[model samples]
Target: MSKTKSPIELYTKEYYAACTLGGIVACGPTHSSVTPLDLIKCRLQVDPTLYRSNTSGIIQILKKEGLGKLFTGVGATCIGYSLQGAGKYGGYELFKRLYSTHLVKDEATAYKYRTSIYLLSSATAEFFADIMLCPFEAIKVKQQTTMPPWCNNVIEGWKKMYAKEGLNGFYKGITPLWCRQIPYTMCKFTSFERIVEAIYARLPTKKSEMSALQQISVSFVGGYMAGILCAIVSHPADVMVSKINNERKVNESMNVALKRIYSRIGFVGLWNGLPVRILMIGTLTSFQWLIYDSFKAYVGLPTSG
Candidate 1:
């Protein structure tokens, strides 16, 4: 019988590439599958009174726009988030290693500031991820928020946006996208790492002794906890992202657009979709980490905390 070769060595280009592939698989379909929830969440964020609740939002969309409406932005969501996941997971892994090996260099000191390392790595990863994600996110938001729905689909939306506003059109919301995602990612990685570490500490079994299934389960729990914090921390900026994409005026600067949206909505409006988002993000984050770590284990790599 032939034994499988050991998993790719950590911190190698191959390792990062595998993680990026894993991220694409983890994020794309999962985010696409949640299109209906995202549709409702975006609508609710844009206009808090759009529907009484998530249930009614679905019912109303079906009643008024048909079943297909629930998946208005699935294509954009899939492609955009896949790209984002690649950058986020892969970059986090790469930067974490670089920061530890090059910056800290000392194992004890690195361990001492591990949380900071997690935060910085995640933030740096997300900075680039959001740039790749911005155009698609703009397209997705416009599709969901428009009364008639923006365009037939992502392709049409892209063509139309390009025709109307050129390349800059797609990037109008980059600033808010960064504001929303950077902090969200920072919270996500940091909290998940810390929480998983804590869970392992509390358990009698060390992490290395745990089966793959058990380790991923810990990832799920930690991810869910981290997600709740992520949603709350980032919701306000998320609201602004949707608003900027849907409501920004021609030639309006990001700052001006932000001020305008805030004036219309007020501070309370920023939290409009809080409850639904917490549910969405908590579930989403758990599954993302679950899938990510599961993929890692399948490839013979160690599961992340």
Candidate 2:
């Protein structure tokens, strides 16, 4: 009789698929749920004078655009981040193993240089993930930041953009999206790994010996810390992404658009939404890791470090 293979076996095709599924589950709903906060943040980034504060922004949006408007890009957020998450988490696992196995070859060497592996793996993963995210992101930002909104929904936005500028309209934000997401993901994955490792090192119980709830708690803590770092690292590019998508003139090249926007917003403008992003990303990331690891554990896989 043939022996049964473990479903949770590391680095296998099944394992990568599980990670991708977990990522989709982790990112899509969580990000969509936070669309109100994101909408406010994008508006703040684009026009700093729009609202007195985050709280006021919420009230203003409610008074002006109605409650449902807070979820302006919920569909795009769900779809785009779901696709990005699949590429990110699945690609990270693949690249991390590939790098450790091929580049270092020795287990000890791989462990010694694990941080670099984590950074490189995440950067590479996010590069492609942003490509998946960019078009939806462009739609989301345009609709959120525009005063009257660019379109009623994701489908309308997509049809209008395609009709207007063909593929280029959807893709014009790709460069800035890459700039925002790659560094953000690198900080997210690397810091989460390091924080989880540190937490395990200090704990009386070994990571493997910890209960499922305990392991997930660790994942949340690590994820929150990683998220704060991610916000700070990626805030500038994020602002630029919103600006470029919202204000780019017809026939203006990305380089020219960026330069003109920068000349106007200057250095202070780039950091406009940092605090809200820290809060948003921290909560969002913590839940993401919690959900992701919970899913992995449910499937009999070990929680990520």
Candidate 3:
């Protein structure tokens, strides 16, 4: 008789290391490609009057600064996202395993509880990940927006901010970040798990027995659903983060700036560039899952099913 190996046996140090590295690699290009959308999103969030229409904003940016300006903060964004991706994906797997072992008993119970686990794990991971990201995010937002050229890149931005604002500079937008990320990750990870599970449950055959194509299709749908939720829940905070990250302030307090933005933009203004954001999130989430799963399969790790 053949013996079945435990899930613990499947999780090796090497597997985790690979997952971390793979996540970083997978996130780099995705972040770089989405820089333009990010720029637009930030602009609309910071100054709604100036960028009321997404198409008009894009056109204005293109006309004044040209296409290259759209990628203003690509470098910082790439670094931040790569690190965040590694932490998020690796942490999710590690926490999921821990939860399954300690909190859940039966395999069926594990599956039932997976969505909660995913939400908790991903949110926890993102909290720390965003700390690492806060400085770079500040730099990226400043660079992307209509900030002065003195803040040329992340390093310059960091130096200028520290010189002016001390340690507080790097974390200027952390409150909004928490507001954005907690809900965004909650929706992203939980929705993904729920959607995937629902798809498999509705299938005629067991998901474990499905072909690779079937698994990929399920993952795509799940990812899209998760992305959509994330985009909507986090849009306002995202705009706020961008505004705080940018904007050289001589007089206005952060609260004042926020109030100004709110007064100018209103609720719908927060959702500026949502269409592009949807595309970015949908593509990135789908690809991240596909790549991570493929890597896991290649490394002989057990599939989620």
Candidate 4:
């Protein structure tokens, strides 16, 4: 039998690629599946008067726009998240290495400050991941927020935005995307690590002795718990991202847009649509970690990598 590699050797360039691919497999399909819920979430944020509660919003959308409307921008969700997954998972692994080697001095320090390392690494990875996701997210929000007679799909939206505002148009919400995703991602990664650590610590048997399904269930629990924090931390900026992307003005800065939105909706409004989001994000994030971990196991790679 071959000898097992150390953690340092286990997470190599190819390991990162596997993690990136696993991220794509995990995030893309799961996010696309929730397009309908996400569509309603955006509508509630952008036009609360019209959309109202989640139940009312769904009924109204089905009645007025039909089934097709609920799936608006799903293509953007899949494609954009697939790309962002590469940046997020792959970059997280890369940043983890950077933090371990350059930032954390020695192994003992690394172990002592692992939580801080997770936070910094997750934040750095999410920053670049959001950059990749921003344009596609802009397209998705625009399609979801604007009613009929808007760009029909991701391709059409890309073309239209290019014609209307050029390359800069696509990146309209990068700032808010960063603001929204960074904190959310930081919470996600850090919480997941801590929760998993907690679980293994509490478990009488070693993780290796647990069944594969048991391991996956633990991952799912950690992910869902993390997602609650993810949604709460990210909701306000998420609202701003949708609003900014759908702006009608010619030259609106982030502050101008934020001020206008805050005036329109106060602190309470920022948390609108959160109940539905809790259900949606909780389930979504759980499945993301489940699928990602499953994928890694299937490919014979370390799940954490």
Candidate 5:
């Protein structure tokens, strides 16, 4: 058998661009659509005494604020996610290449070290991404949790926060953002790669010989595994994001607040809006890979394995 040139071998630059664009497009919509679930999750985390249960909190929002209110900060969610996608996917590619050059000396050792590289690269990328995300997240939280109409949009929301609380307002929940994002990105990117590799290895035919359908199926499975793990591992920090973003004040530190939220709500409370989140992550994640690959192909770019 003769060696076939890999997609990445064909058009590296185009492939990288596609990956970045696909990440933005896919994640933007996914994050926006799930804003309501996020709102409910955050509310429960901040004031367990008020929210009590996810179902009840959702119902209450619908009753008082109407269904549209649930999507209050969707615009911010989209913008924030778009930035995050660029940083995440583009940064991953850049860092992956860097690590491959400096860390992995040969194919024999690639598999063993590849996931670790992904974890490190993704976490680093997410740290910067979350900083860009913090202000938007803060505004989104305020808007979602029954803020006044004047504070409806991002600009006004930021103004209001700054006027009242100053620069510290933007960074109020940043610790939680770091906590949630670093682990989430680590699991999301690393696990996706690992799972895809494992599946391809198990296939009857060599991965290089598999059709597009097989590739997509593998992508879906990999994305699901990554999403589930990301969701579970990041739930605690997620609770923190919700709590700090929504509440005016609670006489407790961040860790104390987290413990209180968990103690009041228990394990189930930690996963308050998990059903919607799972659906959100699974569908978007699967489509993200498909879109990224398709876009790369369209642009005559090389595919990254």
Candidate 6:
């Protein structure tokens, strides 16, 4: 008789699916819910002179475009981020596992090298995640910056760009995206890991003794703390991506676009949307970790802090 798979094998597919689904649910709807904030953030980044604050930015958009205008590019934001989440969380797990096998050592040794592993694994995953994100992100930025909004939805935006500018138009900001996302993700995973370790190290009780809710709360704290750093680290390149997509010509080189955007506003302008970004990213990252780790545990996989 054929031997049955072990317990881990019994739910392997289901558990892995949950890993990806957790990230999708965590990031996609959360990002869509913050569409107004993101829309304002983008405007502040590209045209700070026009928008002095979030409140004023919303008022301007409403007066000029209407309430529906606030949701421009939200569809692309959701779909694109869902794809990115899958690549990020799924790829992180894949690369981390692969690297762990090579770095095989005692638990203490692993902890000693934790930060390096986290950084390298995060960078690998983000590379794949950015590939999924760039096209949709390009579409979203175009829609957000275009007068009266560029297209009705992601599909329309993609179609219009493909017809007009071809494939190159959809990925013009990929380089800046990597520049922004790589550091952001590295800080995200590493800081979250370290923060969680610090928080737990002081606890009277062990992690295994804590209830699931308590574990999730710990993850929230770490993820939020990490996210603040993530926003700060990534803001400059975030500005570059926004400015590049908004003002770049059909055949314009990224270097020329970068020089022009920076020349007009200079270095300080790159941080225009930082406060709003901190709030948005902090909460988003916290919940994403809470949901992602909770799902991993529920599906019988190893949990992280």
lDDT of 6 by residue, 1-305 (tens): 11233245423456556667877877788788888888988878877787888889889889988999988889999999999998888777667766765785766776678788889998999999999999999999988876778899888899998999898988889999999999999899889989999999999988878777788889989999999999999999998889888888888888888888889989898898999899889988888898887776665555575
Better of 2 and 3 by lDDT: 2
Q: Is candidate 2 or candidate 5 better by TM-score?
A: 2
On a 0 to 100 scale, what is the lDDT of residue 28 in model 6?
A: 89
Which residue pairs clash within candidate 4? none
lDDT of 3: 0.73
lDDT of model number 2: 0.92
lDDT (C-alpha) at residue 237 in model 1: 92
Query: Could you give candidate 1's per-residue lDDT for residues 1-305 as a string of tens digits?
Result: 11345469877888999999999888888889889999999999988889999899999999999999899999999999999999999999999998888888699999999999999999999999888898999999999998898898889999999999999999999988999999999999999999999999999988877788889999999999999999999999998999999999989998898888898889999998999899899989999999998998888888897
What tens digits encode model 3's per-residue C-alpha lDDT throughout 1-305?
Answer: 01244333456787677767767866777778878777776666666566755678778888987887878888888888888878877776777778778888888998887777787777887787788777777778777766443466777777887898888877888877878877887788788888888888898987767765667667767877778788877777887787666653655677887787678768777776677677777777777776666655555554443
Q: Estimate each model's TM-score.
A: 0.97, 0.97, 0.84, 0.94, 0.83, 0.92
> Candidate 3, which segments miss by more than 4 Å at Cα?
1-9, 51-56, 105-108, 147-150, 247-269, 302-305
Better of 1 and 6 by TM-score: 1
In model 4, the Cα lDDT at residue 119 comes to 92
| lDDT (C-alpha) at residue 160 in model 5 | 91
Tens-digit per-residue lDDT, 1-305, candidate 4? 11244333456777788888888898899999999899988888877787667788788888998978879999999999988888887788789888988986799999899999999999999998888898899899988888783788888999999999999898878888898889989998999989998988899987777666678888989999989989988988888888778873557877888888788888888887788788788888899999988877666655551
The most accurate candidate by lDDT is: 2
The segments of candidate 4 whose C-alpha lies over 4 angstroms from its true place after superposition are 1-9
lDDT of each: 0.91, 0.92, 0.73, 0.84, 0.73, 0.84
Give residue 299's error in model 1 in angstroms.
Answer: 0.7
lDDT of 5 by residue, 1-305 (tens): 12345445522675566667866876777778777777776555555566656677678878988988877788888988888887787778777777767788876686677878888888888888888888888888777665443377888888898998888888888898899889988988888888888887888987667655566667767777778778778877786677667763634466776666567768766666566566556666666766665555454453345
Q: Per-prediction count of colliding residue pairs?
A: 0, 0, 0, 0, 3, 0
Which lDDT value does model 2 have at 55?
94
Ranking by lDDT: 2, 1, 6, 4, 3, 5
Backbone clash pairs for candidate 6 read none
Task: Tell me the deviation in Å of residue 44 in model 5.
Answer: 3.0
Segments of candidate 2 deviating more than 4 angstroms: 1-6
